[model samples]
Target: MILPITIYGHPVLRKVAKDIDKDYPELEKFKEDMWQTMYFSDGVGLAAPQVGKSIRMFVIDCSNFADEEPELEGFKKMFVNAKITERTGEEWSMSEGCLSIPGLNEDITRPEHIKIEYYDENWEFHEDEYSGFAARVIQHEYDHLEGILFTDHCAPIKKRLLKGKLTAISKGNFKAKYRFTLAK
Candidate 1:
């Protein structure tokens, strides 16, 4: 099932998600649905909060970036209860966008490398290091778990300039192709 993504201004997007154990209901199915939702929404990554779930989880597929970074080829993953143990290297600015915020991209500065500990869909724990585009994607998705949006990284002036557009997105005034359920 392609879950409707929670848009900006939705309370769920502002709440820190809770971690889940293996006993969580239909864990495997939920992960599959997240993948379906992400692909259908044309997103490289999707977090639980984006789908209205307050859970510590996210999915990513960076295969489309293969041509530019062969290391990302077939880089599909499910991160559950993930935590970044280390972030090293110099900071770099890169453009980032979110499915929930739709139709906007901003240059956000983030570290060049990271080491994270997370559980796979099958519940196997793994600690891995990533860099370049891979690290950026993971960092973006990880922010969602912490109730942080990509827009939060915008410069003060940039944020003020985007205020109107952000408001419009919150009120469902934007013509977003993906259906976003407004907060009640």
Candidate 2:
């Protein structure tokens, strides 16, 4: 199933997500649904909170951008209970968008590299490092779990400029090709 994404202003997006253990009901099913939802929305990544689930989980698939970001070719992954131990290296700005805040895109600055510890869909633990686009993607999704949005990282002036658009999104004044649940 491709679950409906929660639109901006939904309280769930603001609350910090909780970590889930192996007993999380239907974990595998949710992961599959997350992939379907992500592909349907034409998103490279999707976080649990974006799908109205306040859990520490996210999925990333960069296959569509193989030509532009070869490093991310065939990079499809699932991160459960992920923790970013370190975000090092110089900061770089990259254009980013979110399924929650549709029709909004902005360049956000984040560290070039990160060291993360996370469990896979099977509950297998792993610790690794990432850089370039991979690191940026993970950082973006990680923010969702931390109750932070890319728009929150925008420059003061840019944030002010996006006020109208963001407000419109919050009030269900936006349109996205994919299904979504607007806050009531």
Local distance difference test, each candidate: 0.93, 0.93
Model 1 misplaced regions, further than 4 Å: none
Count the clashes in each prediction: 0, 0
lDDT (tens digit, per residue) of candidate 1 on 71-156: 99899999999999999999999889899988888899999999999999989999999999999999999999999999999889
Candidate 2 ranges beyond 4 A from true positions? none
- Estimate candidate 1's alpha-carbon lDDT, on a 0 to 1 scale: 0.93
User: What C-alpha RMSD separates each model from the true structure?
Assistant: 0.9, 1.1
lDDT of 2: 0.93
Q: Could you tell me every candidate's TM-score relative to the true structure?
A: 0.97, 0.96
* Worst window of 10 by summed lDDT in candidate 2: 62-71
Q: What TM-score would candidate 1 get against the native? A: 0.97
